[model samples]
Target: MASKNRKPPRVGDQPGFRRALIAAVLVVTAIFIVAPLVVIGVQAFSQGWAVYATAIADPDTLHAILLTVTTALIAVPINTAFGVAAAWAITKFDFWGRRFLLVVIEIPFSISPIVAGVAYLFVYGLQGLFGPALQSADIKILFALPGIVLASMFVTAPFVARELIPLMQAQGRDLEEAATSLGASGWRTFFSVTLPNIRWALLYGVVLCNARVMGEFGAVSVVSGNIRGQTNTLPLHIELLYHDYQTAGAFAAASILAVLAVVTLVAKVLLERRGAGRGGRPTLAANQTVPETTT
Candidate 1:
């Protein structure tokens, strides 16, 4: 009776309460996430392998795949570079308007992707600010590959920088300062000292950035003009297929993105286990040893 009346050591230590919480979470996950994924898989091959194969091989779908890949290839690396540079600048130095620069870098996160796409249209479209100049110069920026890439870049610009800043800020500048004092060049210090420590975090950021670039829809849709086989990306193409009542085709195309998302999730989990992710830091090398001393 006394034992029953006594409280558990922790707020959530009761077995019944724990079971209830776990059950609730599992139910939510199954309904919201696992169910949709299973549906996609089931529908993707619903018409059998031949139909799936045909949908996958369709020229429009293939073009969308290529365009998506092209956008990712171009955008990811540039954003990775920008992220690293911004993180380095913000964490490793003090300057005028430093806070302002940090805020500007994060503006992409606060603004809607659709809004950004519209702004790009105004800036580069035929009726836009530099529209006539670009037209006269035979330069095409809107409703083309360039516009798609630009919109994707804008939407995903903050991913790498957001991932790197916290980890870099936590790491501080002692290592770089010491390297500099020891006559190491800036490039050498960055490659040798800074790069090694931050590689995992950088890779984590790149993975997320690549995932976002491939999956991006809102901004890409607006700027791409949905030119079917021409400018349509995978996300846009999927919408087109679905709207045309090509459920199998849409699911097949969606399955590719789902697969990519799974791969990215796996990579993210692996990196997080390696001590890189949200609020995560890299672990030391296994080979490092402490010096022995005599008393």
Candidate 2:
């Protein structure tokens, strides 16, 4: 007898349609995001290497670049520490007003950086709340380096905490508990177990925080006083160049920032891929089958 014939599955069968749709959406999104970066890079190199050399060689531009790096180096670590502590406090403990504290920590992320600068000014500027006290001590915040660092710290504070909370929650407390049960002290458990688990997420947040600190303009502009070679950061320098009608210089400076951003993104991608690979590895099952009794 002949077997009954069955129709072959169509190429468009199953959830392939949804997968294709998602792929198309991702492609379009990638183009939308990358177009401006491509344009900036083209503009940066279009004027030849001489323009880049001139732009970077300028003393003011060089100073701004250095200041940007310095501010990020100082701010990122401080924020990372704050983020980790905040995340641990809010997630690992029960307390009154915990939700409120979390909301307050996130407020800076929602508020405009310019507004954050203004808020700082209200307290530290010449006419601000502490103006008299600061003046008496001969301390200057507005139009000074302190103001720039504070503003960057304010804006970047939430990055690491936001990345850490979900990670800690998903990871649960079993490993930590196990470590504690083994006679490990609190600090030992945290340093040896907790820190290792969350390090990648913290690093990811730091990379993002650094990128934002390097590129922040609105807040820096408010406090930097736009002092050439004094408080000027790379972003401020780019603005100054644009205002001075050195379009090529502006693009060149912008290109350097673009390169930094690209490097950060590449690092993030590689780290994420490594994390995923580690997570994908299978663990052995607790139960094992015995050999068959009857042969």
Candidate 3:
């Protein structure tokens, strides 16, 4: 009775040992994560605003940015559609080799990006199987835009499906069944019943995938040929600038990628927080939308 009547402990009331542990963690995080970010920000603007602006505004830099964005545009949409389809199929049905398929989808996560690029080269390079025929037709795959897009797709393919499959599986087919029984067509069922339930998670995966696509270096590097303004993406451009003794320019280019990382982190945090809320609503309704349904 006496304990129940006492006030609950506050954050500041943590034991000395616990507080010390937390402090240690904060210090380590600041030293590793925060310090690098600060260095990037400082070095990016180190040469003054005019120089920084000029560096980013350079024709080559602009082209690099455009190429990077274009790659994302091409890769993300295809991956998104594929992800939805794969997730639906994998989670809603049972089949032979389903586990094997899941493992195959997750291959990109385990392999190095550099190795992926090499594989692309061997398959599409001059001496490769289809290379001779493609070369005869003047169709380029290696060290070209197509190669870059393919690499990006290969690297980012699993993200969205990975996010959605487990979630859809957990949700079961109850809502989808309900919708179908109520006269919803297959398309209608997905749009009205399935989509709303997992939109946040889908978006989260897409955001992550986009970040990876934009920042992809190793695979793109092998396939891009580092053609000054033609195939060079932002990361490759950064390397170009640095090697050319353009210190400020390199950092300036890096800043854009850094900002993208920060934005992604922020979105992830916001979504997670919303997913955790539960005030006067269904527990999943905290920051979540209408109840989720499986495919």
Candidate 4:
């Protein structure tokens, strides 16, 4: 009779089950993620510091690094501005086709990078849409820095806006409206009221954007023409080295990208913590109403 009265065990309450799940997750992560990263590091330095340094200091590798950095420098900021404006327009105002604009902003996320690259080629290649005009004007777009930058920008365009849109939507426009009512200019309201509240998300988005720009391969590859020491970015450079059987050099170059990934992850974690600590809202100072301007 007492046995009949015993209740069923709750889900996830069994210690054995929990332990098994944890063990499975750890095993998978170690094999797939951790093991590969460890192998890259080990192989990169396997040939001694001199070899690794030589690989990194190679002229082609240096140019690749510079090209990657330059692409990121150009793409990230423009995308950031575009994202901020897009989010602001989508969330802070009611207008016709607002939903359409939102969908357009998200198009890049849905489209394949390689496909975007192909599309750019059709539009900018030697025999492409504006090709003749460009040729006549002596403007080179394909197989150059500009092509690489455009590809990177296209692939990373949505990052900042995607991060900001939901957060800003949740925040609504009350503070911005209040500030505007108190004689604050549009820029003033944005800088004072909106920026502080969304800074963490903005920063998180920028980090992710920058990381993607640096590591992008498919789209850039299609557009850049893989000119050694000219248009090849780091990822392409890594591939070139591996193809040439310079395995250590490839791994060394890949290590730089891995380091960037780690830094981005760290920044993401820090920003999440900071946002959580503040409830993802502006501080009290930012909440204060703007003083009205007197004549």
- In terms of TM-score, which candidate is strongest? 1
Candidate 4 backbone collisions, by pair: none
Q: TM-scores across all candidates?
A: 0.91, 0.83, 0.88, 0.90
Best by lDDT: 1
Question: Residue-wise lDDT of candidate 2 within 1-295, one digit each (tens)?
Answer: 1342266556565478868988998898778987889988888778899988898889999999999999998999899999899878766666677666766776777788889888888889877999889989998877888889999999877777777766775676789889999999999988999999888887888888899999999988898899898999999999989999998899999999999999998988987865622221121210111111222
lDDT of 1: 0.87
Candidate 3 overall lDDT versus native: 0.85
**Model 2: lDDT of residue 92:** 67
Clashes of each: 0, 0, 0, 0
Error of 2 at 242 (Å): 0.6
Encode model 3's per-residue lDDT on 1-295: one tens digit a residue.
Answer: 6985487666566588678989999999999999999998899899899999999999999999999999999999999999999888877777776766777777787778999998888888887778888899999988788999999999988878777776787788899989999999999999999999888888878888999999999999998899999999999999999999999999999999999999999987786665511111212111232123323
Single out the weakest 10-residue window by summed lDDT for candidate 2.
283-292
> What order do candidates take by lDDT, descending?
1, 4, 3, 2
The CA root-mean-square deviation of candidate 1, after full C-alpha superposition on the true structure, stands at: 7.3
What does candidate 1's lDDT look like per residue over 88-125, in tens digits?
98778867766567667767777788999889989998
> What's the C-alpha lDDT at position 122 in model 3?
82
Q: Give the TM-score of candidate 2.
A: 0.83
Model 3 alpha-carbon drift over 4 Å, by segment: 1-14, 276-295
As a whole number from 0 to 100, the lDDT of residue 161 in candidate 1 is 77
